[model samples]
Target: MTDTTKPRIVITYCTQCQWLLRAGWMAQELLSTFGADIGEVALVPGTGGVFQIDCNDVVIWERQRDDGFPDVKTLKQRVRDQLEPGRDLGHIDRA
Candidate 1:
């Protein structure tokens, strides 16, 4: 069951591309940074070179559309923007 009250981050990566580590790493980063701020971070397997990050069903980062994967700082910013617009991400917000 999912807690719809809080924000959910879904990371869909291409299974054929062997991007599980990448997706998992990103999930870890988000979890570590946001902590309890986010409800969950899900890793969904996909194919055809797909790599997307969705927050609460809103696509925030798409590998094809965004050109490539997002860096940690950018990912953090995007998540923060969606979940808590006014929240500061310390050094991440500085750069």
Candidate 2:
């Protein structure tokens, strides 16, 4: 994506696992933080323990590989790193 273009973030979660809430919550976090910095935050329903976050078609996080769901803070940082690498996430950026 170009500097003028807003990247798309897609969150794929396992519907069978009832992880939609988590995915939605992540979407909320991203939207709340990035706001106009991002174009879209989509929630894709998947299965088989799949919980992945994709930005501009690149897989940033995966549940099975990571071994667990990411907390909202961590996930937001991952997104900010992609969307705007130098952008600050306020309190979330602090350790």
Candidate 3:
């Protein structure tokens, strides 16, 4: 699938180490929900709680961090917005 563009999503957490795990969980959920391929996890040591999610050459959604864990609602919205167009993830077959 060299030519094929898989769905790529980046999940970020707050500078605090705790958010790393939390963000990872959210990223996993999104991966399972959309069955997207090419899932990516990025951690920003210094930033304003921002995470980026890129979906199959369709859209790039950024997630803002809060004091507590990230809300799933925001994630769902971003995914929906990106997948709305005909991006075609090609295949989400990953173990």
Give the TM-score of each candidate: 0.94, 0.90, 0.51
Q: Worst ten-residue run, lDDT, model 2? A: 1-10
Output the number of the lDDT-best candidate: 1
Rate residue 80 of model 3 by lDDT: 56
Tell me the tens digit of each residue's lDDT in model 2 across 1-95: 33437888999999999999989988998888888888888899998989999999987899888889888888888887877788878898887
lDDT of 3 by residue, 30-56 (tens): 766666444443333435655454455
Best candidate according to TM-score: 1
Clashes of each: 0, 0, 0
Q: Assess candidate 1 and give its TM-score to the true structure.
A: 0.94
Q: Write the per-residue lDDT of candidate 1 for residues 36-70, one digit (tens) a residue.
A: 87788999999999999999999999999999999
- Which residue pairs in model 1 clash with each other? none
Of 2 and 3, which scores higher on TM-score?
A: 2
Task: List the pairs of residues colliding in candidate 3.
Answer: none
Task: Write down the lDDT of every candidate, Cα atoms only.
Answer: 0.93, 0.87, 0.52
Model 2 residue 6 distance off true place after TM-score fit, in angstroms: 1.0
Q: Alpha-carbon error at 53 in model 2, in Å?
A: 0.4
What's the TM for model 3?
0.51
